[model samples]
Target: MLVGAASMIDSVRTWLRPDPIAERQVDPVGFAGTATVAATDYFAWDQEDKPSRTTALDRIAEPGADIDGWNGAGKQRVDGVAVLDVNRFARELAVVTVQVHVIPFTKPAAPSQPGGLKASWTALPARWLTAAIPVRSLPGGRFALSGRPALVGQGHSADLGNDAATEPPDADFSADTTVVVSKLLTAYGTGDLEFVRAAGAGFLGLDGAAELAELDEWRVAPKADNSGVRIGTATVRWRLPGDATLACTYRIAISDRDGIWLLSAITVDAGGPR
Candidate 1:
């Protein structure tokens, strides 16, 4: 009777347990269009008149697949698709999670106590590959790998960076540059010289308000260096009202001045301030 009861309890527990694999998604467009590698060849994927993200991913999974059909496909705007590579993608996330080095239940910055940043990779591959996807909608967004991560501290030849050097530092720095440039441009457009001078003290090179006011429009063209220190470009339509747009490249340098990442300097590259 004891053995039978135990058997019954085990059967009920098995039925009550949830499946291991889980559903996840990422925006492929976000991956390819900015700060990340192309989930798949965008040009080739857009071949379908009305391209489907899943179809594109399926084709990408094929080896040396002829993707010519996707060529010359018109502009594509993809969003809100799920990524289904459970084993690999989740493994990446797990790596990211372990990399945090903070105790899961404690404050992130608190020092490690005893056993810290524990991880087990034993079941990850099976979890990713064997996972079931009940809903088949909008898949293949995972391939949109984020920009080359500064994946330091992972047994690599460099203890130079901090442990909390999470995956998105490069992405964060790049985004910050865009914001600064935009702020400066807005001040220039609105003839707010006082604001410009104050904000651009460490950055912009302007002769005077009158010269800045000449900029009819300013825009941060998406072209930028993908490296850790992003050097970005902005198009300044000089002599505003009607002037050629000058491609201006600004070097964004981050410094640990006073132990904080103040935007140390935003100097123009050689022949940069046109």
Candidate 2:
């Protein structure tokens, strides 16, 4: 019978797959604080604590979640939550998202006819929304709320900047690769790893964690497949701690050795593409 129907379709596809390291042994930061306290008690409420906010959304949703279709007219609060993204989907599902902030819950505008005289305003402009939730996981690593928390919408814009690999003829570095990127950003702003191992850098310097304050622009390219590397791109300026500054741009690599140049590697270009 055609080799017993291909060995019972390979034992029903190994009992319907799943366990390819069950979603890489999950750990979306252990359910981002149970999806930020179940989307902050699923977008709070307060019509005089509607029965303890319906007993905190029936102790974190999912037992027939409709989230008690709020009949208790307006009023929310939150004022801060966070999380912002998790997704997952296996080793016990996941979703997360978050953001929040809210505020609403106004009261104080009436006064059009009677003893006209009120307009003091009490609240209702704050905003930031976003939500999502879903969660699940449990069994020690903990997390729950498996449903109700929709809202969402805020994330649209993608170009992945390649603007012709940062335009222009640019790509000529040999003035000792601009003095080894200005003494590796002045020994990465003074935490000087022995002047970056006497400028041959094997890595490790931003030890002072930033204070350079200026070296504001640079560029080089030539690594089409390494002719002894080259790739730079600088553009710095740190300062901070009140004396404010912060510019940043890094993307180095340099290397040349023997004919010296060194500095090896760096990162933080943080734009799209290359």
Candidate 3:
């Protein structure tokens, strides 16, 4: 009974062709051998004087001038040709080192995928993952020392129709260096204070007000007496001069948001006394 029902459904589908008339038309440009060429006849030539040919061959091979006979044509000696010496050639060369630092506002959770997930699944959320660090300027120092900040975590997605299963999320930071300082300074000097504040707060890990205040060499400290907000001496060892390097350190403190202070970012300086 099931087979008969399936056959009836198939018949109905076959009858519903959208362009039945167009499908029935035949093509006019059919394949066929239309024309042929005739074969031609061949002819042979008589041989030349054998004694003259022998004498000519003997004269040609008389000495080193034509020692190899007629076949030794256009051979000459080449001198001082330039070529690459294998020992002197450089191969696949690269130098210097790179380091990256990241600090999360909140600790990242483990990856989870919910559902009978397919291998081709792709989805990314639209949000900003932020980290905060410290920035300081020395007394009478024109430049400020900015630390690194980043998002170092993964995300997960739940399975369709089943809330229990989830998929993994990829996490990364947008800005990873202190070069943004020049732009931030320009924004501040031009009275685009909000832009300056936002850029400093996001990149240097300072609060909006703190970022504004720090424009004039303000001091930074922990909220409470015992909270550890002050980051001590940060020594940057130069591997290569005028190259960017990143480092980070964290401390606990009491504040409006759990007092967990995270500091991160890349620093560049004029190769200090060495």
Candidate 4:
């Protein structure tokens, strides 16, 4: 009886006629493809490319049947679609990180249904699996992961070079260093490129290479509060574009250059030094 009911529901869904109201609501620009889904690519939103919201759909449809003729063009029907706003998602993750404890984890062999003429996670009379992935970002520097079996099986390949120093700095620049680190991360969270540009300077960021670090939610604490000689430590996550993120805790040294505090030395967590 349950199987019969399920089959009946499937048949109903397949036989149902398309909704004209819903068809009118489809966005041509967004429908262009994944490249435009991020909205960061110029081709996705270029005025010349998107003459009307439905230009792509209209072009292939029969002249008189504007909205009703795409099927005649032999294109498969679409069920549902969505776009991810990664930046907004990142912000939301940030908030969640501050509000809760998130234990990092990874899950493999997760299940799914496949689809399309080509092979995919949902494509069959099959039991397929995949890994967990991030789907959205949260507030206070947090992000969430989602899994689709279709995206499984792909392996990552990249090399991380190393050259950072290994020793913690002398315990003399704690307060100033803490303030600098705080400001740097705050500016990074807000995407303030200018501030980030300045912070990447010799005395602000440990290395002059400040732009390399992205995913910036972090914690900083003073190792010693000797007033005259302050030492601090921080654990940070760096999300490099198209690369694996690296987690490390490092130390810093602040200097007084004519009254203004500036960072002068940095020691990345090199396994040898905690």
Candidate 5:
């Protein structure tokens, strides 16, 4: 009877135990577009052939600025400039309201987590607006792909030594380069596991030579009741310093008879100079 009771108790414990979900690190990929301004001759006034007459016809050249499109299309013209006078030739002007979009992939929750997922958008300001040319010019140049925002929080992880036995230093989590995170998210959606791994390893400064462990513990809490597990759907806002990258790790956990098992770890790369 004692043996039977023990068996029953084990069964009950097993039933209450939660299973360990798969664990893997996710890395983000990056994509960027620069706003450009070009000089286009919309309408040119022909020079009047008649010479001596004291009064020449009032000719005008309407020069327009074209900003490259953001989502795959023709360049867009700068607004508020029409009918430029001949006297104003080679004059300078400023364009305002240039916009760009940075999108990231949707993250998935570990199987062990509970509650529905949630996701939202977060924005980090650019360290400095990288205008192709000084804002003084009418047709401004394109913003270059250089200049990253400062990193916030801790910096990147340190490298491990040649021997596999030694552990690597912890990653610098304070660096806040926005570009890193944006790039990471892009890679995640495309299923570029290599890129994801590289980003994670670089940001964390883990043993590059060593293999990364899969996600171990998964847990989820609902924003409200009745909501299912929804980790990927939720969004978290973060900031970084000038041209620096930010890295953060989150864990997932599950309950078991013995205790709790780790399921996965998520690393985020964020903030960089433009």
Candidate 6:
């Protein structure tokens, strides 16, 4: 009788225990893509195609959400949309910030008298706008807008502060590093892989994608944080077929084996000359 009572008690406990809720997984890239598409559709309209716009909103957003209340007076066009930031609040919810390049235009106002003004569109300048969109995840890899997007101000640029030093070339190995950089760039200009392999050793170059017109400026700095690795920055001008020139800045890594300098890697640094 005691064994029976104990078994009943255990069964009751098991049946009464609550099941744990599994957290939903969020895909940042996929969510960004969805947000971009939704933003594009939200801004695109011809006024005549009202049905299409309504259908698009219905597919992406919930019912009765007034995403865009354009009184059919103005037309908005989207030039581009990019994901600026993604902040996930919970496993199933997030707020994605996006930059939208849009062109807004409206029809001219009717004149007080007939034939006073022509029926032409007064187009405003193209500009960028920031938006914060609340999104929620659903079952089977689907997403929905929890609310309408709110237009916000521009995003702030990063400030590294004034005390940051632009690492200058090391005096001792500057000349030697310059020689290695010149050789690699010369070979890279003509798409000469064999010469680059011999000069840079393990470095793979641009495969002659650009014609190097001039090596404008270069600076070498031994990495203060890492020994045997020196950082180099160079501004190179490229010659286009129609006599056009494009100047680009590149950052390169050089390995110092005793005194021999070898190119380790090279890449374009952001905010460098366009």
Top candidate by lDDT: 6
- Evaluated at residue 203, the lDDT of candidate 2 is 44
lDDT of 3 at 244: 16
Of the candidates numbered 4 and 5, which has the greater TM-score value?
Answer: 4
| Model 6 per-residue lDDT tens digits across residues 1-274 | 9999999998897668733343345577766877898888875665545787778878887444445433343466789999988766566666677878877665456533475644555667777656556566767678877555644323311111111125545656666556667776776666464633334345334444346667767776654676676666666665532233445555556666666655555543222111
- Minimum summed lDDT over a 10-residue window in model 2 is located at 155-164
Cα RMSDs of all predictions?
Answer: 23.4, 17.6, 36.2, 22.9, 29.2, 15.2
- Displacement of the residue 231 alpha carbon in candidate 4, Å: 4.3
lDDT of 6 at 224: 65
Total backbone clashes of candidate 5, pairs 3 or more residues apart or in separate chains: 79
Q: Which is the leading candidate under TM-score?
A: 6
For candidate 3, the lDDT comes to 0.21
- Compared with the true structure, model 4 gives a TM-score of 0.25
Across 188-269, the per-residue lDDT of candidate 5 in tens digits comes to: 3233435343322322212211122222222233222332211211122222121112222221111122222211123221
- lDDT of all predictions: 0.28, 0.56, 0.21, 0.28, 0.22, 0.58
Compose the digit string of candidate 4's lDDT tens values, residues 188-265: 333342433323333222222122243233233333454332224444544322222333343434434445544333
Question: Candidate 3 lDDT, tens digit per residue, 1-274?
Answer: 9999999998888778635544533221110000000000000000122343334333322122211111111111111111111110011111011111211122113323367442331222222222221122122221121222211111100111111111121111112212233344333223343433321233232222111211211112212244432211121111111121112222111112243223322222111111
Off by over 4 Å in 1: 16-38, 41-274
> What clash count does candidate 1 reach?
7
Regions of candidate 3 where Cα sits further than 4 Å from its true position? 1-123, 138-141, 150-248, 253-274
User: How many angstroms is residue 28 displaced in model 3 relative to the true structure, after the best TM-score fit?
Assistant: 84
Candidate 5 lDDT trough over 10 residues, lowest sum: 38-47
Candidates arranged by TM-score, highest first: 6, 2, 4, 1, 5, 3
The count of backbone overlaps in candidate 2 is 0
- Lowest lDDT block of 10, candidate 4: 93-102
TM per model? 0.22, 0.27, 0.14, 0.25, 0.15, 0.43
lDDT per residue as tens, model 1, 1-274: 9999999999897778733343344433332232111222322122223446445444433233222222232233323222322212232221110111111011123433567653321111110000011111124433322111111111111111221122233445445555555555545434443533432233323322113322222222232344323233233332211111222222334333333333323332211011
Pairs that clash in candidate 1: 25-83, 36-147, 39-144, 47-70, 86-128, 87-128, 216-240
TM-score: model 5 vs. ground truth: 0.15
